[model samples]
Target: MERAQPLPSYLVHRYQGWKATGYADNQSWYRRLAELGQHPRAMVISCCDSRVHVTSIFGADQGEFFIHRNIANLVPPFAPDGDYHGTSAAIEYAVTALKVAHLIVLGHSSCGGVKGFHERCLGRAPELAEKTSFVGRWIDLLKPGYERLGGNDADIDSATLEKEAVKVSLENLLTFPFVQEAVDQDKLTLHGVWNDIGEGGLEYYDAKSKAFRPV
Candidate 1:
């Protein structure tokens, strides 16, 4: 087996700097968190995009939110076939074990995953349409969102599809019996949001109006 390489010099230096500053300043708080374990109020499912800074967006401190990031912030409908499911595993843990009060699906503008899905649907990205491509299969979960846009790639808008993908994820979340039960009993709430990366603006889905509103 190949040995794992050490972190890059730049990352190592940054880690040292953080340990001396951020960690030093909040050593006690860190210790308390270690002792108490996490008791986060919400679980955020967001994109793996580097620019989408989850903690910075909410001014969240360590251990405040149980966050899961994937290619397009998608959640597949419940399928318990004993197969490997990373995202579903995270959701199950958050809902059943952590008992998070809220589950939020956060989408962002200019998401590469969303763009790739759009291109794939339009047959512009043949690589993503291949069955063996992991990313292709992952983004295929967004097919429902694509279909919602009339399934006519020629007339589609990527921006609107991004928000629709968020809504689709929220819908898929309820497919889990645990999540459905929690929502039905008022034990957990689900939220969908889209962030405009360029403008630093956030809009949340309003179920009542069936639209996204500025937050």
Candidate 2:
């Protein structure tokens, strides 16, 4: 392993503040979580954007939500192709091992990854096509999502595709047998959420209405 570095000065200061405040106030709760282990009821898959705060949005306590963040908040089609699937592993552990009651796919506006995927797929960004581009390959997962939504138009607005990313992930999450089985047994529920960062508004996908309504 590479040599490990100490925490940055700012991070250390923040840690000390939290230890004196949040952690100190929740010592028993923290000890309980440590002793009993985490039994979060929901697993949230959200974009790795610094602006999207899942816990704060839901007013969730520290151990209440198990969160997995990735580029564009994507969940690939269940392809047990024996590749290094970090997202898949997290989902598997959350659903089968943790037995989470809910799986939430959260999307957001102004996502850099989504923008990258949109521009890259539509041929607007040629630099992302280079072989060494990691973002290009990661964003490539959004291709199947766009195709499912029948959005091949290079001129289509990226914001629309960003919402479709949540839809595609919700669809793809069912491809996992464990998730499907859990839902079939009514042991688990699936949710899709979109966050409008600029407006401070949240829209929830209503399967019956087939639309996102403000929550």
TM-score of each: 0.97, 0.93
Give a tens-digit lDDT track for model 2, residues 1-215.
47988989999999999999999998999999999999999999999999999999999997899899999999988999988998999999999999999999999999999898777767799999888997788778787767766665545666678888888899989999989999999999999999999999999899998788899
Model 1 ranges with Cα > 4 A deviation? none
Global local distance difference test of model 1: 0.94
Candidate 2 clashing pairs, residues 3+ apart or interchain: none
Query: For all the candidates, what are their Cα RMSDs to the real structure?
Result: 1.0, 1.6
The whole-model lDDT of each prediction reads 0.94, 0.89
User: What is residue 177's positional error in candidate 1, in angstroms?
Assistant: 0.5
Q: For candidate 1, report its TM-score.
A: 0.97
Model 1: pairs clashing at backbone N, Cα or C within 3 Å:
none
lDDT of 1 at 10: 100
Off by over 4 Å in 2: 1-3, 148-155
